[model samples]
Target: MSALDIFENDSDDTKSAIMRATYHALCEHGYANLTIQRIGDEFAKSKSLLYHHYDSKDELLVDFLEFVLEKFKADIPAEEYDDPCAHLREVLDHVVPPTLDAERYEFTSAMIELRAQAPHDEAYREQFSRNDRFFRQQFADVVRDGVETGAFRDVDPEQAAALLVTTINGSMLERVTTDDAEDAIRATRRELDAYIDSHLLAESGE
Candidate 1:
């Protein structure tokens, strides 16, 4: 599911609506041009409701980031796969998809724009740091499982996870900043798959 889909399952309908509106607005206008008025234009409720909750655009966005982070954690399929190799592939695909459609590309570009503010915004920095740690731990957990099941070579799970996470971050940055995003993504996928085959997958698993 798309990241925005998580808002649909929220218990609080108002908050859910707001988040969905914020997502669409961010995707449409981007981080630089995003405004409370623009978000309210997407929102079905009164604009005063948005102002009632947030004093400024940054305040609303920080809360939006937190909401996104929680929803993202809930969406992780950590227990969905019995095979370690398949689980690893699933994780990799989620982070770096094979294709970049228009909607997804726009969303990713907006998110990267938000990420660029991390150096200046402590809240954004903290949220992103938590996100990174969570994803890295997911990778580490799968690697540990693989090792225990003898499906992967005995490797330091933390180190392997770190490498994979770093690769994913770099690939995402390249996708947003570079013109040749598709080719770059393809190259990243190729190298990452090769890394998995040579470093993680055992002969039996392969």
Candidate 2:
């Protein structure tokens, strides 16, 4: 029996299988091509089964995206830095190794495609916007804390947050699929460090 057929639409097992099938479908096919027909075929079940669990392909896709996004959020190490730049080190430490590994590089392409096409789907666009804002806010909160603690160089944390996010997003095109990204990430950090340090540090010693 197909994985979907095993769900058999009776208990929680079916719901769980639907989610699993959706994720496998997304990783293999991406959001644009994923369909109820494909999902049903995979399960040797009817398209109606998916609809019973999810309203539409978009709904399933959103669920899949949320699953991956949650995993990404969970992998982030606890914040150890009071300063934003040091917080940046936490991000780099977490992001750098996976950037080089093709097998583990699952989040980049799908995220890029969704972010780029969000404008076309009103609901998807809103959800994407919400996620973007939350990410920025979290980053800004860390930066702001940095300023209050005398760890970060004094600057507009909001602007710094935007710049920091932009830097990471831009790097995705080059780094996510690359074999060598250490130099690029390092250079970007240096420029950012100079911009921030000159303002935050004591001139006499730092």
What is the TM-score of candidate 1? Answer: 0.92
Q: Encode model 1's per-residue lDDT on 1-206: one tens digit a residue.
A: 36656765567578888988998899899999999999999999898999999888888888888888888877765455678888888778877886777777788888889889899999889888988898789889889999998989999999999999898888878888888877888888988889898888898624
Which tens-of-lDDT digit does each residue in 21-70 have in candidate 2?
A: 66556556665777876766666456677878777788776665565555
Candidate 1 least-lDDT 10 residues = 1-10
- Please provide TM-scores, in order, for all candidate models, with all chains considered together: 0.92, 0.69
Candidate 2 overall Cα lDDT vs. reference?
Answer: 0.61
What are the root-mean-square deviations of the candidates from the true structure over C-alphas?
A: 1.9, 6.7
Separate clash counts for every candidate: 0, 2
